[model samples]
Target: MADELVFSVEGPTATAARQISLAEAGFTERAHLQEWIIQNPQVLGEGVLIVTFEFDRWRNATGTAERDRLDVLGIDRNGTLVVAELKRGAAPDTVEMQAIKYAAMASRFSVQLLAEAHSSYLSRSGASVSADQALELLRTHTGYTVDNATFRRPRIVLVAESYPPIVTATAVWLGEMGVPVNLVRVQAYELVGTAEPTRLVSVSQLYPVPEVESFMVGPRSRGDSEQDVGPELPEIEWSESDYAKLRALPPKPTVQAILDLCSASPDTAIGLRVIEAAAGRTVFGARGELAGLTMLVKGRFKRRNWPFSVEWGATNGVNQAHYRMSAEQAERWISSAGNLEESPTSRLRSQEINDFGSPVSPAPHKESGVTPQ
Candidate 1:
């Protein structure tokens, strides 16, 4: 990030932009800074997609938790929610803790809530888009979908004019602990012209400094249930109780429909991207459901806590984990899922195939032994 800017006059006179604090420039967090990020998200990081700002929708049904709002909610290319806390001036010591809390709360949000939030943001911002359109737009851009999806773990990005030493220390510690918290410092410069003044901003990463290799790749494709670390299990048989839990799991109509297509060739392991395209969702959308399925079986089977579908274990050496089972198992699981009971409330919601029709056919898939899976 640039510290200062130099400007030249048409004549011989030249001038340099003055450094200033955001407060000194009278720029506020919500009005100026958040809007800037919302308009141009590249300032946050490469491929960081915005979901909404001022997100206060985490449910507090117990009436205990505070309705604190996160400033800018977004997603990294990997589909993990980017919980950004913005401070116009220096960030306080508790900022890291605050952002972590928001990230934790965000895990409870389902695909619908995120789409609704985005739709609300678009309408309020004068786009006049409905939830379905917002869902489709999000799916098209980021591969995120409302069908049978849950948000992957959220990644934290804290932006401020400056961060106090304690704040950065905590943020660094969180990053080291694999919490995915990042600190970005914004520098303010005033470009003084003969006619008017223009404020310029430059951002430089702090916590996950250039050396932080772990964060460079973005978050792994894992769901909230995978947070509980345990030993690794290559394969395992789920108990009958495992099937019951799977049956009781929230119905993901769209993901299941996509899997129904995959069931046609169960022995072959499909690439992660192919399945994502067929579902009209990003890898994160469908993968979260798959991860949840793996976790459910793990919870019942008490295996190593790594993601493993009862149908098949995760294929290694890939950015996103892909599982394969005998075509029979694939068909059995999805076929049974379609029969799982939906409560009256859930049945009322239109099935997951609203914007997109039932795919005429499944996307292409490679043979399992042929692929890395």
Candidate 2:
């Protein structure tokens, strides 16, 4: 409600607005803003609708009607079609209507048409991406699905400092009708008297408090609610007998079990291999087998981030001992016992004296002080 809301292709005049759009500060300083966004996406959350490379262009319409100019066309993460018209400076209320007209044009377009446009944009920018490749990459990077079954919605993003009250009210009302509308306010700020004021900022959707909260917090709460309440029953209680059963079983191949189940080749080697899921490529490296196996176990367990404890014991003639041990201690036992020739039975007994049947002591690692040229 402040009259200080002056839109510009520069920094915001208010501190609150600046923090919201800190990353999107400069708009007129060439097209660096778009590049900054694509690179450092952590600045914004996944819900962001990215519109890249906007320029004023007009295209003639086809058929019996007179030809008309199309305003803006953008592709969303799911490759959803977005047709928008940007209005800068003091524009007429009619600008919103014109944006709707552009959206209508975009709605008539086939997915192939949008795909071609995406490909062209990437190509002109010298990016090595084919049409299919671009779509695939965008799908993964943006977490937006672009299938025929997905509902396509038209978007109208009004980039201005302020909108008329009617426009604001209309956008909200249309939003209820399934139309996606975003009124982004671009404002300018100058640091006076020793304040560095060369920055440009954009405060997107400053007004409409409830809508902002719904956009940020609503999705997360819904997801949390839908999540399983977790096991209704309490955890299993193990006694000394249970510990003896595991100790007697011996350390079996965890990773190898997965590989065998998946029918993966046994010759795949046991060293470190960085497997890329999308590319289906694995980079291999060699180190002590014991160390690599231990790291793999630690990495998998860390992902759980669960709150629980596990312990190990030794199985001897008629006597079974089990005690609680920390995660670190269990891993150490496995490393020591898992060797080329060591059998599970021998390792189990050795570990009882060595500690809860962990692997083995790893070789000491030295810090490499050498620098590469």
Model 1 Cα shift for residue 238 (angstroms): 39
lDDT of 2: 0.39
- Candidate 2 C-alpha RMSD relative to the actual structure: 17.9
In order, the Cα lDDT scores of the candidates are 0.60, 0.39
Question: How does each model score on TM-score?
Answer: 0.55, 0.45
> Least accurate stretch of 10 residues (summed lDDT) in model 1?
364-373
lDDT of each residue in 32-106, candidate 1, tens digit only:
988888998876777777888887644354434455777888865445677888888888888888887777777
**What does candidate 2's lDDT look like per residue over 30-67, in tens digits?**
24433544443322322344333443232333222324
Using TM-score as the measure, which candidate wins? 1
- Candidate 2's C-alpha runs over 4 A off are 1-72, 76-79, 141-144, 148-151, 195-197, 211-373
Point out where model 1 deviates above 4 Å: 1-14, 61-66, 144-152, 192-195, 212-373
